[model samples]
Target: MQNEPLAYRMRPQTIDEIAGQQHVIGKDTALYKMIMNGHVPSMLLYGDPGVGKTSLAFAIAGTTKLPFIALNATKAGKKDVEDVVADARISGKVILFLDEIHRFNKLQQDTLLPHVENGSIILIGATTENPFHDVNPAIRSRCGEIKQLKRLTTEDVDVLLKRALEDPDKGLGKTPIKITDDQRLKIADASNGDARKALTLLESTVFASFEENGVTVVENGTLDSLIDRVGVFGDKKGSHFYNLLSALQKSVRGSDTDAALYYLAHLLENGDLVAVSRRLLVMSYEDIGLANPAAGPQVLAAIQSAERLGLPEARIPLANAVVLMCLSEKSNSAYVALDKAISSIHSGKTGEIPSHLKDTHYSGAKELGHGGYVYPHDHKIGTFGGWVNQTYLPDNLIGTRFYDPIDAGEEKRLSAIYNKLEKFKKEK
Candidate 1:
């Protein structure tokens, strides 16, 4: 026990000893009750590393007094899972803790389906990635419960730190170390809500302090070295990535510049340039179309700039585009118009094209009554040569209005000209 790392030594022996995750493991909660009753179903424990997934599994096995078989899915093969299943068959029941379960392929995961479906093995699959995307659907469906453990809060980290300092059997109580509340919080902040990481850093800092000053006091300078590195908290292929991208796009569409910038910072921090550029480009046309015609072009230019400049520097141009998109007069008129037109066609309202509007450049087209097409340029009205009131849509959809522009931004001036054209056609 003394040779084990501080994190391992400080593993919670019971559910009551587990810190954080009160929502799932608190008293009277379903999970808590399940463990207390010793009837835990097959479950997938998912979250960022060191937030007590393995600890929770151990706690459940301890409470249930079931034979706990631990195996890392990253390196474990079908044989390893089969061995556990075989043991469960002999022993009646077994709790198998498979860590990094996402690393297992479909074949490796399928090996446990039969045992899991039977009462042979109660599988507790743990992963940092989202189970829905990374785990096989068959394996996931068999796991009756999927609980997400969130990052540890500052308060939770504090509890762990204090417990470690005082626990004689499993922690640094023998070292007589002293850590201030502020210093403990700084360590927690640097840990990024990982309990294992926090305990590891605390243990290392204590050793460093003793080695340097021959004392057990951790100084601010000692911690500064360990916490300087940035810990990015996101999996690009997981749900966190999509959720952030959705927030960024929605913020821009809703014209909330500050919120857009906030989410953009997170994307840039995560090095998701492609998602940032793609989502911003979509926002330019989908949310700001026609209302601010220049917005789409400006966003395209920004995307090009970002692609050329690449990260760190790319955030500048992307930020500019995001601000412009959020501040621009917003409209979805063109998008809505296209959808309405498509709906009409899909609903079988598409009538035959006017014979005059059909191509007359082909041979015999004129003889087929595809002639006398009205040329709007021959009767140009405005300085730039506007069109006549000849029908461009199908005859049945002649009076159907689709592109209804709101009186916002550039659409206001265009709407005035459109109203004028309608009045002229009425008079004629």
Candidate 2:
């Protein structure tokens, strides 16, 4: 008999045989019922590789007893999809499983839409990429999406390892090597919630044990050797994302260029690059405003460039912008000014615009004495001092200054304005 790959050989023959994905395949779930009742919606299963998406697709096909047609979208195109749909229609019942569905271009994906809608073939798309960004909207809209959660917890991996070790027909039950709790836990840690990887690592380690112990027992050294060779990245979830991001943002806010660069590296390594770019853009406004007013536009420009170029190349511009934002002189005057203005308005402390400042756009406004305003341009001083009339600020903050400019490049001009406003207020 020809040998199948370990992944295929260990495939779950039934829903019960499937490990994890309890949210979708658990008892009485929509997916479970659909598989059991032959009403499975055309679905797009998205997750990192080795997380049971493809296995689930196969198990569902087997349970429904449908003629399963598999396609790797990387190699297939519009003509290939149309041929598959045409042949499947003749077969009466077919479930088309498209692996790496994101690889299919718009034209290729469009060919499958009519067949999916008409029920000629129930499409089951499996993708490793995030569906929101990778898949075309039209193709994605047609399929019900289920995210396959990454294998991260020890408990989930433990169950999977036990199953692989126990199943004689499918797994390495025939192997003489025995696994201890520590070995299993370490393997689980190494796999990082990826079951396929765990199994592969397990198989290799067991083979190593056989080589060393002569088909009788497995030792810790064998497991350790396997673990040493395997790499594991900790799960980036919950507070890790927010806490680390807060530090990065604060470093930039504090204008510590070195500290900001370190935090940027941490964010790039542990967090989403896109998320990092977004937070940096906000910090440009909240921390670097007016003092280096150009920081905000630079960050925005980097964001646009990053989207167009994607990672690696995108990383260069994003990193450059991040460093520039950190080194830029800090000022929150604009943010502070807006906050006070908003607070005053919220407290019902705002007044009508001075009649001189009111709109003169209409003839009726002019008739109502709206255009009887002194033109600042028409004055020799070209400044607004006596032009002020009715108060818009509250009693407690009538002349309360908010925007105090730093001695940074462009902000010196604003500092001059602040000085002029101060002198004018004193004269009044």
Candidate 3:
């Protein structure tokens, strides 16, 4: 135990000892009562990395005094699952803790369904992704409940740090290490609510400080060095990645330039340029389409520039694009119209193309009545108008208008031209 990493050594042995996540494990909660009764149900634990999902699973095992079996979905195969199920069937009381459950494929997940349903094994699946999007719905249905663990607050992280410093058995309590309250808080803030990361940072800093002078007192400089090495509060591949991306896009959609830039910086700092570029491109079309016709092209150009320049230089163009996207007139008419049209198609709202709209360039087309197509150029009216009314859609969709332009950006001008076209066709 003394040789183990501080994070692992300091893992809480009971639910009450776990930090944060009171919403799920607090006394008097259904989950608490369930654990206390030793009637642990199969559950899915969802949250960002390092917020104590695994710890909670261990705590539950301790509370029930059941045999705990741990497996990582990333490495565990169908055979391993079968073995666990076999053991559970004989043992009668086994807790199967599967980490990174999102990595389990359909077949792998299905392997556990029978065992879970028959109550041979109590399964605790943990994942950082949204279970709805990542988990097999069949497996998800079998899980008695899905509980989300919230990110730890600064105060919660501080408590863990203090406990680590004072625990003589599993922590640095044997060492004469001294960390100021401000230093501890700084480390907690730097950890970004991840207790494992905070403890690891503290452990590493203590070693470094002790090595320097034989006295373990972490100074500001030593703490700063460790914090820099640990990077930021959130993992780029975890839920934080999607959350920040969502916030960035929403900020841009809401026309909050400051917020947009702030989220942009967060992504850029995390070195996720490709995701940032892809999202910006999407926003150009989905959120700002037809509002500023130039927005789409301008964003494309910015992405191209960023790709060519890279890094600090790339950020300039990306920043410019983010600002422009936020400030541009917003419109989702095109996106909404496309979806509406697709929905109609999916609902069997389609019909054969009008004869005149069929291909006329092919052989024997005239015999098929394809040559009767009217040319607008032949009916020229004004400088811009060789206008003529014609059946451009299927017979059933002839009058089914889908593109409704919003009265914002260049769409307003487009709406006038469309209204005029409608009037001309009506008159004819």
Could you say which candidate leads in lDDT?
Answer: 3
Indicate the worst ten consecutive residues by lDDT in candidate 2: 231-240
Give per-residue CA lDDT, model 1, range 295-360, as digits (tens). 999999999999999988998898899999888998899899899989988998899898878888
Error of 1 at 382 (Å): 4.4
Taking the tens digit of each residue's C-alpha lDDT, what string does model 3 give over 120-183?
Answer: 8888999999998887787788798899999899999999999999999999888878789999
- Residues 361-409 of candidate 2 have per-residue lDDT tens digits of 8778867777556554444455443344234444555676656667776
Error of 3 at 216 (Å): 3.0
Q: Which runs in model 3 stand beyond 4 Å of their true positions?
A: 77-91, 104-113, 210-215, 232-243, 362-364, 372-374, 377-386
| Candidate 1: C-alpha lDDT | 0.86
